[model samples]
Target: MESKRSKYILIGLSVFCILLIGITSFKDGFLNPLRSGVGYVLSPIQSGVNRVGTSLYNGISNYSTLRSAMAEKQALQERIDALVEENSRLQSEQFELQRLRELYDLDQDYMQYQKIGARVIAKDSGDWFQVFRINKGSADGVQVDANVMAGGGLVGIVTDVGAHYATVRSIIDDVSRVSGMAQQSGDTCIVSGDLTLFGEGRLRLSNIAENGDLKDGDRIVTSNISSKFLPGILIGYAADITTDQSRLTKSGYLIPAAQFDSLQEVLVITTLKEEEAPQESTENTEGAQTGA
Candidate 1:
């Protein structure tokens, strides 16, 4: 019976607390000072929480905007790099085009011979460029012993020919030789290349007559005695001349007019000189018998 009385007392206390809160809410005049003070203290805490939430939201938005901006910047940088590369390529192409135009003008000035314009395709596959391949070949009328020129000067002679390509032995090659004459002095000499004498930028001009009047800076040109190369093509310029050990002939160095190392486009003379035919056999034999 005592336990049952304790339970009833606890239930009565809860009912009194509920009635007090209900009356405070319904009656406007029941303004308790303690409750009002507690609410005033908590209002500042609620406002502070709201401010913290708003600041965090703004910070997140700003961070997202910064990330997007960085991505855009990276994209723009890539585009700029691409544009720069393209601009460089176009400039190089323009320079090459200008160079080819100059070559074309030089070719037109030499219209006496049938010429075929060809690009240098490859250099010899060895340490030295003893031979170089041109884009023109038998199909283009290029043949062995054809004269090859670049930049208004003789560069080489075609040594081998294929259907679509031809190989030229440049003037710098050791095996190449040309009959040359000093334009100013009228001194005849043989222009020969030696690999060991390359770095000096010169070719050997030997067989100069002891009495020849060769001087410094005399221009050398292909002589009429040259069997393969056409006569009058510029070979090089004469340099210092010295007597041989026996003093039988004079030898000198020649500065090649054509920059063989930097050759790009060359013209190949395709037409060969027609040989003169002998007189008719019957008429010649009758004249020879009468003279005998």
Candidate 2:
């Protein structure tokens, strides 16, 4: 019975509070401090919750933007790499085209001789193109003792020829010996290859006439007496002419006209001198008989 009486007292208090709120809404109380106090307390809490929501949203948005920027940067870098590779390929092709054009001009200049252009396939492991191989041989009208020319002058002789390739022994080789003469004075001299002197881009010239009037910077060319090379092929310029110890002959250095440092393409004169052709045939026949 006492529990029942307590429950009734609580219900009565709740009704009284409701009636007071209704009276405040109708402005029945002076100043209405009840509504004013509730408003003042709840406003700051609602504002705090809204600010936290906005900050979380902005942070997620910024993270998405950063990821997008990284992806774009990676794509741009790949594109730049591809462009650089393409540029290198174009430059290589341009150089090859230029080299072919220069060879064409040389072919025209030596129109009197029958020439077949061939690319340098291999070179000696030394500092010079002393002994190099070309991409032409017996099948292409190339033969042993055939003269090779490049860069406007004699380079070497085709010393060995196979079915599809030939080996050249350049004038710069230590064993090379070419008979040449001073273009100005017709003074015959032997251009002998000396490995030591070749290091300075020079060849030994011997057997020159003491009174040949050969001087420094005189043009030297292949003599008609050369066994393998053709006549009148520009060898190089003569320099430092001096009387040899024998006093009867003069000697000097000959700077070769052809740049033996770089050999890319060459012209092989197809025709062997008429006198050498028979001897070459005779040698080949003799070698075949001996093998048999």
Which residue pairs in candidate 2 have backbone atoms (N, alpha carbon, C) closer than 3 angstroms, thus clashing?
Answer: none
lDDT of 2 by residue, 1-292 (tens): 8999999999999999999899887784656687778779988888988888888899889888889988998999999999999999999888777767776776786676788999999987977788899999999999887888887778988888899999988887777788788888887888887778999988888888877788899989877666566677888999899998988988889998888888888889887755433323322111111000
What's the C-alpha lDDT at position 254 in model 1?
90
**Shift of residue 262 alpha carbon in model 1, Å:** 3.1
Predicted candidate 1 versus true structure: per-residue lDDT over 116-233, tens digit per residue: 8899889966554558888998998998878888766778788788999988888778767787888777778888877678668888888888888876789898765566666677
| Stretches > 4 Å off in candidate 1 | 1-62, 126-128, 273-292
Q: What is the TM-score of candidate 2? A: 0.72
- What TM-score would every model get versus the actual structure? 0.71, 0.72
User: How far out, in Å, is residue 191 in model 1?
Assistant: 1.4
lDDT of each: 0.77, 0.80
Candidate 2's displacement at residue 152, Å, is 1.8
Residue 286's lDDT in candidate 1: 14
